[model samples]
Target chain A: MKKSSLILASAGALLLMAGVYLAFFVAPDAVVRIDDRELVRYSQKIFYFHVPVAETSFVFLLLGGLFGAMYLGTRKRSYEQMSYAAVEVGFIFVLLVMITGVLWTRADWGVWWEWEPRLTTFLVLTLMYSGYFVLRSSVQEESAKARFGAIFSIIAAVNVPLTFVAGRLDSLKPVHPTVFTLQGASMEGPMLAAFLVSMFGMLLFATSLYIMRLDLLRAREDIEYLKEELEVG
Target chain B: MAAGKQVFAIVKKDVLAELRTKEMVIAMLLFVILAMVVFSQAFGVILNDLDRVGGGLLWVAFLFMSMLGLNRSFVHEKDEGCLEGLLMSPIDRPLIFFGKMLGNLLFLSIVELFAVPIFFVLFRLELGASMAGIFLATIFLSNVGIASVGTLLSTISINTKTRDLMLPILFLPVIIPLLIAAVSATGGIMSGEELTEVYRSMRFIAVYDIIFLLVAYALYDYVISE
Candidate 1:
């Protein structure tokens, strides 16, 4: 591995460890006093990790869109591969967000799921990208697969925000807390710190995974090209 | 003007072809009516919430019916190598997209005109003239969104190994927001709710139609190209 990636991997590992510790121990538990008993929402701790993973997923999906557009403009396989890698890593994070999110929902709301804006949009998003992979596979030709995948990614990207808006429109009564906002006014103090730590840590982890996957995919593509050349020659 | 002519020519060709065979439209009509029959059986006969679920049922049928229409839209073109010929022509690519999308919109509207009445009769629902107008408006806007996206996706699906099977897999998730808005708008119209109640959904459908049309138009060149 390159020294930069090695450093990145180590840094990601350290920050992730620190973030998890801070999430559990350093960050104050949300406590409720009821009937002479102290009730704590341990499930709320999942929020720190879940929000970070979800944000990282969005960032990577956007990166996939960017790379997809680049692939179309240049017709370069490299950009397509990078976009695919980003989507794959992003999808992993999306699954994590859902798992952790469902856990939190079950704990907090006493249901396995809620049709809140974010949750519904996430479901749409997961399906959209899953369809992306499905579309990719159903195409037989390599170039056609890349082209269709790129176009689909761009469409999916544009739809993401629209889905968010529509989801928000229907969710007049949101079960999820509006912790982070565009204006950035809601959360404060240690909660904010913990969130930031987890956010950056998860982002770093996601980036490292994307980079690693891209490298592996590129190497595999190179091997396949060489084999094809040998067969033709 | 040249692009307009090309678009019209393509639309005319598709319409004439459909007029000759009438396969796509008939299939869509039957599929939708059958779906309505099934839903009425489930909701009207068994559960007895046909009124409550009418909007959902309508949009669901519309979505699947449009999927069927779109999946078959490019079949004759692909089978006859007509799509390849179209691509080789000097016509601009997005114009091709608009042509196909417009053709789809026309056919979906025809199916809707037939299906809506049958739908009401089957489900035993009543619609005033104004309510019918609102309902048709929702269908039109939703159709625009569906046809625009569906046309783009069907082009890609035509090139895929699974052909028509890939269309719904790619189309459904992408159409969720439009579906939500359309279903809500239809629900509002069906319940005789205030225009304000359906206003947001109507706006959403319109906006979704415009955005998806533009995005699909912009991306059509890449998809139709080799």
Candidate 2:
């Protein structure tokens, strides 16, 4: 486990460095025309990292849900730990997505924020899961905390797909340009390599964070258990 | 021994308790009325065109009012150790969810009964002749959606220190689809549009109600067991 974690950590660092170099230097600037105004933009470079992070966060969220269902079925403490870890990692990645999104919006949309569907839905998901942490902390009893947190996590997880569907199908909803089809030069060799590296790096970073947090939580629990044993002795 | 009898007993206990105290119902109704008055005063200039904004105001009032009722209902159970007793009973956990949801729906509907008229009076808008029944259906279904999910979340939140504040924070995001559906349906009805136009939103709310209720019902056991 230690060796694998160390490998992931090194790979993540290497990928992040590659991503920064490629994003700033290798990727060409994108030109967009809005309201007949041709805007030559460089900040479109954020897309390489932004899109992959956002995609990864959703994957993490879905994994969290899957772990939540497992916890409910097996009633095992490990599944709950994994689920909590996934959500914590998901939160960090989602926050990074939001920050990059804001930067992109300010450059492209002439505003720091807009209520576009993707942005709005992601905002809602961020709040909903953050509330999950608050829910966990509010309960003092370990058993009750685990039970309620698991249940809430599962419920909130089900809402994610529904939210995505609702955002897509609502007729009154505003349109966001589909990233894949948008006008941009297709990824060249170096840029593609850099993007993949960064993506792998983010996954490693997320895994490391999850493992660290879980270890800390388990250690805390161990301390509490030993204290109780000492008191009884 | 009978399932029906157990369900009846649970419902009766909740109803009788609320009847004697009138705390949850009265507080919810008063809060809705006061909120409406405050809204009206705040938007006094827009009163002349109240119909334009009435649908939004009605939903805002309902959302906050439901929050008030949900928090109070669970707090009452927690206050007297009644929820612990309920958990200790041999009855199915889902039944408790149903009983509590029914009680909340009943109280919310009664509050709406008063709120609708007060809203019409203050806002000077009348439901169109053709849309009255659809409006009622929207209200009924919206309340069911709110009560079903609200009951389960309130149970979870009641254990937290920030019980009152926590309910809305935890609830509003989960129920955003319901809010959007209710507001759109109400808007459609107010504007004398065809029910078919609002069918999508109604179906959305119905689907949400079923999915969430079933999820909440299945999970209630774990929540109360701990």
Please tell me which predicted candidate would have the highest lDDT against the true structure.
1
Q: Which parts of model 1 are misplaced by more than 4 Å? A: A32-38, B45-47
Q: Write model 2 residue lDDT over B113-194, tens digit each, in one string.
A: 8878877776667876657778888899989889988988998998888878789879988887777778777887787666
TM-score of chain A of each: 0.92, 0.87
The lDDT of model 2 is 0.81
Identify the candidate with maximal TM-score.
1
Cα deviation at A35, candidate 1, in Å, is 8.8
Q: How many angstroms is residue B11 displaced in model 1 relative to the true structure, after the best TM-score fit?
A: 0.6
For model 1 the local lDDT of residue A10 reads 76
Task: Give candidate 1's error at residue B123 in angstroms.
Answer: 1.6
Q: A1-233, model 1: which lDDT tens digit per residue?
A: 85666677778778878888888888899887899999997788888888888889999999999999999999889999998999899889888888888888898899999888888989888888998999898888889999999999889988999988787655245778877679984767788788888778778777788888999999999999999999999
lDDT of 2 by residue, A1-233 (tens): 46666677778878888888877777656678999998877776777788889878987887887888789889899888888888888888889888988888897778998877688788888899889999999988877887887888888888887777666434456655564545754656766766777888777877777777778767887998899999999
